[model samples]
Target: MPSDCTHEPTPATQGPKLLEERTIGGILVHFVAIPTGVAGAGIVYLLATNEFTKRNARNALDWHLTVLALTVVTFGSLFTYAEFTGQGVTDVATLPSPVSTIASVVIPTLLTLWFLVTFWTFFVGLIAMGKATFGTAWRYPLSPALVDRYGSELDFPSKWPFVIFVYVVLLPLVIWGVFFGSTDGAAFFLSAFGLLGLIMLLTPLTAVAMYLHGERDQSRNTDWKPHVAAFVGTPILIAAAGYVISRVFTESMYPPGDAMYVFLAAFWVSSIVYLVRWWMTASN
Candidate 1:
């Protein structure tokens, strides 16, 4: 049902050769968001020599763009509202009483929607990739059929620079706002939730980026080990250091608030570092 256009198998000599499903699936599997999937798709689309390969690449590229546009319009607006009101990433009690109604209703609803979109994109993308490997030319159900139908007319390569600006320039600034704007406990949690939501969205995008950029550790055939080391190990090491500092310097147990803050701080810091490294590889 997902792949509406399954390329019928024909002799290798007839027309264009069939694009390998595993190669496409592998690409889809790595697709995360701007820095990863979008950039990766651009890279693949540019380098692909075959018509079939180009079509699949174009389809993937357009889908990522569509998903990114939808996310920005929906979550971006809500997060902006949260920033302006100072309710989401700050102390809620400080806000005027009337605003609470909006906060209680809007934040949860937006968060749910954000998660649904993220899950839907990843789930559908993965399924489509798997199906494509079996002889179908898969397309995202929600993706506009612009690339396949008007392949000749659309100049997708021109958009790559804008995509790069979004990842390297715009996103980092936005994330900074979400984190620093959140000054209170309630704000920290809410903002953290929002930031984490972005990270989740980036997960798939980054995967594709790494793959296309040839950043994968060929020895392992995956980058899981390094990510685990950075994500899990860094937090643990920071926590231990915090505990020591609290005992030796503060003469009290490590402040729970500080602990949580440090954990978040470490996570984001590590995430940024990893993304940068991956992006550099992908860009090259």
Candidate 2:
């Protein structure tokens, strides 16, 4: 029995391998960004559209939709550009180049900052709503200014502010990543982070749906049912749209690298749907 032999792996070593496998499986779902972006955008788009179309709702939907559209265009263009020309400033012309260098830089940067502010405003509004719902005596931080402009009743006691916040925080970050970052950045930061943000925003909507469903059992209110349906339906539609866009653009339009734009467009449409739904529901 003199020969030195290798021992078999212990259960302790095998445990880590098993855990790693599970983690990898979880991460795999995050690899597809276009679908996630589409879903998130869809949710916002439906919400905004609902608000804008509602007779009694405030006029905030118009602003929300405009910002959302601009953000998508900016990000989509950047993705398309990167797919074709590769990342970064390829041609550095001083002025009057085909590329509007100043506009490109300024627009993205300003949009991103504006989104951050919007997110902050929404966050505050959500907190205010929580206080109001719980019967606390909390006034909105900037209520006086908002009330002076849009009136207090229009701005208060609703989820629109928080919805806007989600848009502001998410869209700008996505645009920044696509326009400014590398391939890995696009995949991980822009896509993955964007999905995560969407999930975060969806959490509240899901809770609201659940609350509404429960309330329906006690009371006769059926309003929450549409929201729940919208919540479930929008994501599926966005995913389908993404797949369709991928197929159509890859087949009929530009070459392999240019297919990203199609995905972006599909996602944009999905987002519009989401905003519209929200706008309709939230209006008083």
Candidate 3:
């Protein structure tokens, strides 16, 4: 007879480990580090190693930015304008009739709006924090989906930094070129055409590459039709609608001077549509 023997399972035979990095980073950004503000949230996004964590960080960042924008529009800009113009209501009773009317009416209204916006920011931030803690997918209401619009293409680890670089550096350059480049015609033409060409070339290449690699490795089972429609249809639809409006209504109402605004609006709308569709497909 042999003595009783014991055996234990090794780490190699253990089941897959739970992923908590993204969840933790998200909690830190939105909940644990709320007082640290947007800078802290951005740091979380940059330091996040996985897509889930990055998405959470992205949500936090977008929420914070939205809050900042609301603050600026409601309170900061109004106060600054009043101060610079010397129209700020220091002593309402001393102000002239027109100024007193504005101070009495508009100032209180703006202050109320600011307070509402501030309260909204705090409430939504808390909600986002709760969602992140549970490892759920979260989107900030009314915040522009800047990351979701572009981040889906960033599946590859190596391309992450380059994408960040493009947003940080190249985007501002392109904006400057578009706005100011017309002053120097030759340089503008070359720079604009060159930059556009580079973008066009890279976009298709990146799409094809992602398709091939993702199909093989991850296989999202995405339908190409909705994406194709969104890409090819949005601009056409907007352009057609605008043309109709210009012709049927007064062309003076939506003049050529505002074409840039129309273009930007159309671009963002189309991008959001495409990203939403892509996310739905990927999630399925």
Scored by TM-score, the top model is: 1
lDDT (CA) per prediction: 0.55, 0.42, 0.55
Say which prediction, candidate 1 or candidate 3, comes out ahead on TM-score.
1
Model 2's number of clashes is 27
Q: What clash count does candidate 3 reach? A: 0
TM-score leaderboard ranking: 1, 3, 2
lDDT of model number 1: 0.55
Model 1 over residues 4-102: C-alpha lDDT tens digits?
888977766654344542355334533532335555565566556655556666777777767666666666656555655664544233556577567
Sliding window of 10 residues with minimal summed lDDT for model 1: 157-166
lDDT of 3 at 192: 68
Writing each residue's lDDT as its tens digit, candidate 2 over 192-263 gives 546454444444344343333333322345352334454445555665666666667656454332334333
Per-candidate TM equals 0.42, 0.29, 0.39
What are the C-alpha RMSDs, in order, of all predicted structures? 12.8, 19.0, 16.7
lDDT of 3 by residue, 47-92 (tens): 5667777787888777776665665566554554454444443312
Worst lDDT 10-window in candidate 3: 202-211
